[model samples]
Target: MSQPPPPPPNQPPTPPQGGFGAPQDPPPQGGFGAPPPPPPGGFGAPTPPPGQPPAYGYPQAPQPPQTPPPGQPEGYGYPQAPQPPQTPPPGQPQGYGFPQAPGQPGPYPGQVPGQQPYGYGYPGAPVQQPAPPQGGGRKLSTQMQIIIAAAVAVVLIIAGGVWFAMGEDGGKGADAKGTTGTTGGGGKGGGGGGGTAADGPGKEKAPANTASKVAFQKPHPKVTYLTNVVGSWVTDKAYVKTGINSIVAYDLDKGTELWTIPLPGQVCAASRHTEGNRTAIAFEPAKATPPKNFQPCSEVGAIDLSTGKLLWSKSVTGGQGGDDKARFNEVTVGAGTVAAGGTDGGAAWDLATGKERWKPQVNAEQCYDMGYGGGAGLVAARKCGPYDQQYVIIQNLDPATGAPLSQFKMPTGVEYASVVSTKPLVVAADVGDSAGDGSGISDFFSIDEKTGKLKAKIAVDADRFAAECDVTEVESCIKVAVGNGRIYLPTEDHEGSGEYGQTNEIVSFELATGKPTSDKSDAGDRYSMFPLRMDGGNILAYKEPPYDKGGQIVSIDGATMKQTVLMENPGVESVRRAESSFSVGHSEMLFSGGRLFISEMMISEPSDSGVDDDQFYMIGYTTN
Candidate 1:
């Protein structure tokens, strides 16, 4: 039998009911609870446990001077005199010393009362919710109820195949070079180069055909679990692993580091290989001590993976064409190509030489406006105009040179859309915002692959469907996934007000006719479910709320529009983005060796405002 687990450091001598030693009481369920009613000693009180020697194990938190109440040295916890508000004078940064706005006054409108401000300020603000249900019972709008119902129905759908892993027996493929298990022309995806000839990091020791089970990986792992180590100057021995300090190849069974290969700089984006076998990694050497102006070091290093040699390194600074800052959105890897875009413009490079393949002029100010999705090479982009203007332009690029192979321009404006290269088409959903009364109209458009011509168009009752999901703002339900002869879009009602109305519902349309794919569910909207990819003629979504079920992967049958919960996230919350924010910070999921691999991040409450939390973990797992 296993021995009792050792007590965690700093935990109370008596173990809490939960193995984690979390507070016995559940977290405050709603809005913030009134600040803990001053500590037992009263305001400006001493840290408690009245009889014990000062809780020495825990670090002492700095406290304000004791409050003297009603002529007494210290009585009630309330302050004797109101202290000045904690804020920097005018432009100065408070405490943390970063140039930014003060806390409390929210950056966006409609923050919940008593709740911490969201965004760059407070990290985990309570999720916005509508007013309590009406009447004797909570009268959840039909949409919200459907969302909850869908979640419940999904929980019932969890069964066999939920533990299935993709490419379990290994994938079969032959590239132009007649190499088995290789993808493109040169035995690698991009023009960058091929991985070291040495068997992949886990090639030999990891069994020949079967996929590794989640339980097989070591516990508490780093984020970068498997690297496709490819680049110039790399030796045949180079390998990649999930280990943090060591990205080197190791013997699969013995776990020995094969060779030491350094990255371009500290705090860098993950390295990627282009379809042509070219590898790219951006290095910000000067990030340690930022210069007065936030000019990112423009050094972008590209290396050939096959021969392990650096091919080109460029410093993209302010130039008429794409540069580092503007070009820093995504470096997409596709059929025989790799690309990136810049503010006011974008440029595509020849995967082989890092030479400019194509460049386009875009709105500069709007492109680089301290948000994400600006750069080119993103699978797709939604065009928005200056200052609240919502018009859109979607374009597909030429693989060899990132030129607009096709473009879709809308007369009014489209909120969001999805583009699939395999389908060679772009589908956009547009809904005119309501002036009042909280409802809107929806329109769908399909553009030709070669030219931006509208191949087909259809009208949709967006407000009706959106009402099902009381969605507010842009990012709430803007995800679109294309596959299985259909397009799946997540949406919510467009009640102009910030609060009220948020629900979950997937709007599915036929690929050919642009017609509704499924009858609307009569119940409340589906909640906590986001559209994943369409596979095996089915759509996959997160069936349960992200909070309750960690690592729970679900699938939706494209034909029946039925839901299936595939796998439960083992104590892991899939990464989520805050509404209206830009930077597409990384989410851990990828396809490798014919299997689905995911990395889960373990985060904590920030110690203080403005300071980046240094603590996080990258746990790895296979879908099986």
Candidate 2:
């Protein structure tokens, strides 16, 4: 992997040291050399007037021995050389009346070495010395006690100032490093939580009516059906499929098309998987001919999200004859591989170099549904046997090489409905429906993916399996999502009268116990919600009401079931009735790189003028 470039020269490489408002350095050390020699004529310079006892206050030279005055002390009367005053002890300061030798230690215990006492250096200054000890030691002067106390107070004030400054900068520093505690990589996609100044917490939510407040809108120039919308790792661009054969990259913020790539054939089905800067587009081609029973193409292709360029293409051949529709029905991208599976089997490719890594062996007699197993591996459901004795075999395969890691048969009487989730190992299937029609109650089974053993089973009402407005089969209405240790099932309310059209109620069940949880609330009663995907710890839901002219994209907390309206579309309304497959609104919505893209597909039959008409439009919004 390559390293990022160095910062610009004008920019500082690291944060400033010591933080702001720190104290300045203390004043330079004070002078401490011995005091200059006393000025001329001062105490030691010259003897005072002769009569003044030689300025030493000694009695005039003792009388030469005035013959002993009888009883006068014999020694005192004798001529004795004038004796000097008692000398002070070493390491003790001389008193005001005494003269001391140079280089002698001071009287104070903690005084600076070789420095004169403060009062001793100036003329006429009061010089108080420590009192001589009688039996006990002398005490420190009151003046000395005051000096020590003042020094301690100054030190404390400097320390407190430093501590307060660091506390203020700590929060800002973490945010600069993208450690805001909400999401990684700034909360792009339905992956995690993160935000900028405008989208972070405490900001007012976007208005419920946002059709006229759209930030950007772009329409397709050519007649094409919208397929999917993918975002760049940086959240700056959107890769949108205008049709199966063409994909256009648009500036997410500017609403301008950046680039477009055209594929080789009419696309039958497509899926997108993105990791970092790379996005894998796995699409199956449609066979031209009898429109009702179309055959699957022989190969699938991959494309680069940044450049809109084809990276590589691989063959997907295995099933029976030329008319056998063996095209990949499902395509998923994982950490290291891009996998595509259909009735024929499944194949995996290296994401970085587009090399074929592995292909799984399949029973030509069985039909399968494939999906990525939360980057852990590939998951599939294979159905085999006669209609009355049907059995669905579930397998977990190695992501690197298509080998089965675990396999188990669905409880005897049930047929695979769909792989609701692989992370929590939840599967939805139809129970006891031998006719192959999805009229029976749907059963949700939680399995131990590692051991391929059944953990729990819960039966859901049959009315919850009604079809979506655009699809005729009931199976299309049953959408399941798993996250935050729970399974979310969005089911249509079959009880409501036609006056209100169709509305969906999302029911959440605990993954560990298979029991309904209290997190479900009445907030979703007024609108129809479709499970999209999990965004961090929250579940992203698409809401459309029966007769309202606007719709809302809500994010429900997976743990608390607290609902937050993320975006609203005032101009987009649900189609009251399905006119045709192409006329259905709200085709698909995707959250990527902190942005959301919603698309609708519209198609018109050929007119008498021989001009075919088709229209596609995508709306974009910044989630952050």
Per-model CA lDDT versus the true structure: 0.37, 0.48
What TM-score does each of the candidates earn? Answer: 0.45, 0.55
Per-residue lDDT of candidate 2, residues 330-379 (tens digit)? 56666567776655556678877778876544555554444343343456
Q: Which ten residues in a row have the lowest lDDT in candidate 1?
A: 182-191
lDDT of 2 at 172: 33
lDDT of 1 by residue, 170-246 (tens): 11111111111211101111111223221112111112333223322222332222222111112223333323322
- Cα RMSD for candidates in order: 21.5, 30.9
Off by over 4 Å in 1: 1-261, 266-286, 290-312, 315-327, 359-392, 401-404, 413-422, 427-444, 456-479, 490-507, 519-528, 545-550, 555-557, 560-566, 569-586, 591-615
